[model samples]
Target: MVQDTRELNRTAVLTELLRIRPASRKQLAAASGISAATVTRAVEQLIAQDLVVEAAELVSVQRGRRAVLLDVVADRSLVVGVDLGASNTRVMLADMVGSPIERREIATPIEADATALADWLASVIDEIAGERRDRVESVYIGLPGAVGRDGSTISNAPNLPQLEEPGFLDSVRARSGRPVRADNDANLALLGEQHFGAARNAPTAVMVTIGAGLGAGLSIDGRILRGSHGVIGEFGQLPAGPLGTRLELMVTGPGIMRLASEAGVHLDSPADLFTPDASEPVRSLRAHFDQALLIVLTAATVSCEPEVIVLGGGIAKSLARDLARYEAMLEHHLGAAPRLTASELGDFAGATGAVVAALHEVYRGLGVDERAFGDLPVAVPASA
Candidate 1:
């Protein structure tokens, strides 16, 4: 029990250091709420483990002495985050500080079976890692479907048929020689928002992604609420329309295109919806899209009562100029609604979330309480 207490204190100190690096021992103690002696001890152990380093000392104004500032050893370890979308797969290599060191995107093997997709991912990992592959402590893959309770099986993914195969995740693990973590892409996007974007300090939030298909990621009390079968945010499957069409069929990119075509607009891409000179048919399409979005947001609002709702994905970003109008409509219908905002991380939100998830696993492996580092903002490189 004494050892556990020490470990918790140590984790608290380390977490504070990571959140606000280059801090004096006194600052760390104050920020972490740990005793000065405990902070000193933890800092010493972390320094010895090569996980933390002391930078230039800060000269005290009142005294002649200088205080050392400690920070995490950014390059001591690395992690990989993969966002596997229906059309493309993005891989990011990040240092311990969550700064992207390298990033690449490849066409997703949508037509490939499980084994083929696994092999492709293995090759991509090898290419990205090069000589530093072994330094990768963990890898996280975000899929655009409902991940099973165990985090491997794909219970439902209509866009990516490859995930339906048994042992798909196991095969990826076997090929990569590293345990691969998986989650719904939307869930990862929400995780990304919490760690790196708009929802950083929000206790409860939801991200509704309108891309090739509609999905949501919910955070309740600062924790993701993955349902029993990991389909908690499969909002796309909700029935809508007079003929009982799935909600996604009316709001997603492809759905919008189809609707526009049916209305005689003949839109070639969803981006055309944002064209300045939209035709009458296109105007009708927007109205339909907004109505469908309202249904999804209303359900999310009444059920989760999120503090904020972040909208993401290609279609959402393209129509970002009109989000406020939708928010107002929602308020009119529900009396009060969560603040609606666009995702700052854009398409990279899922990949960033995967990196955060892998970092959490790394903390767990090091016997550190992952919760100790609450609301630590991810360090996104300016170039990335």
Candidate 2:
């Protein structure tokens, strides 16, 4: 109806066509409610920018008239995914299709603050870009905290002490010089799974991350559910155990160790929980994990009734041998069992999730490209 509305509709058409199926001018016009002339003009602009290209010539069977197939040029754009944790930070460079080209992981020293961490992440991305930095579209970071409505970290995360300071998002953005998207790691993980892993076709699902901390990410009708406060599926510190033990501290490595030690057994490491002798500490750890998983499944099912439950994070892999145990526990609580599977991405899930989120944002035109950083201080020495 209006000029701006027409432009917006054109972009929406391009995005929807690229998302569903690559189509020609006629198809674009039919799908987008725009005129065929408008579709051709918009498609020409996109092709000039190398964002879309003619894939193949299709001919109708009736008259055999050739029609060129238009498809998104996926490699023309790229995004950087950053996963920041209390102990580590990882960076991944990926194409618009969410396929990674390069990845790097580095340990975050014991007490590094947010500023220092963002600097390191930016440097890693710069190095990854090298000379082809102009093509990178955006940077997305996944962290273990609630992302506030205004893109700041809420005061809920005690683990990230540096985030307590005011203006966290602005500080990170200023240093990185790239638009940054910060989301809960679990939310990103669920997205990564849906886009690239076990839940590809699942309409509704839940991804449970069992690690140093417990968290859940939810997807409903194929879209991630970020609650009003952006704390949709934060499962940490919830009363998860029979005696009201905090869920996160009870399901993690430290949690298992604590529970075992309190049961008068010594579990020096997570590996020790799998002893052949069936030690009391090992048994106690198993029981605690089972109970915690039951609570998690119960809560998750009652809320989302997901088609599948994906187990992700460090602890999930470690507990692979005891998957049956966890499932049995879940069954005891919730009569019918949902399909459960372990994450295939392993330690890379968060980083991969970040990449997926970044690509989605790029396609939606919601974030700035990394190479679009005009004149910020080259945080990393270029000559390195």
lDDT of each: 0.84, 0.71
| Off by more than 4 A, model 1 | 57-61, 377-384
Model 2: lowest-lDDT 10 consecutive positions:
375-384
Q: Compose the digit string of candidate 2's lDDT tens values, residues 1-384.
A: 686765665575565455545577778887767888878877786778777788876746346776877877767888888777766777788776555777877876637676775566667777877775788878888877778767775555656767656777677777667788788888887777776677767869999987766788988887778866777777765775667767777777777777777877776776676665676647767766766767777788777889888898777877677667666767777787677888866667778778877766675573222332111111111110
Best by lDDT: 1
Q: Identify the candidate with maximal TM-score.
A: 1
Cα deviation of 339 in candidate 1 (Å)? 1.2
Candidate 2 — which residues are off by over 4 angstroms?
2-9, 20-41, 55-68, 275-277, 366-384
Q: Cα RMSD (Å) per model?
A: 2.0, 6.6
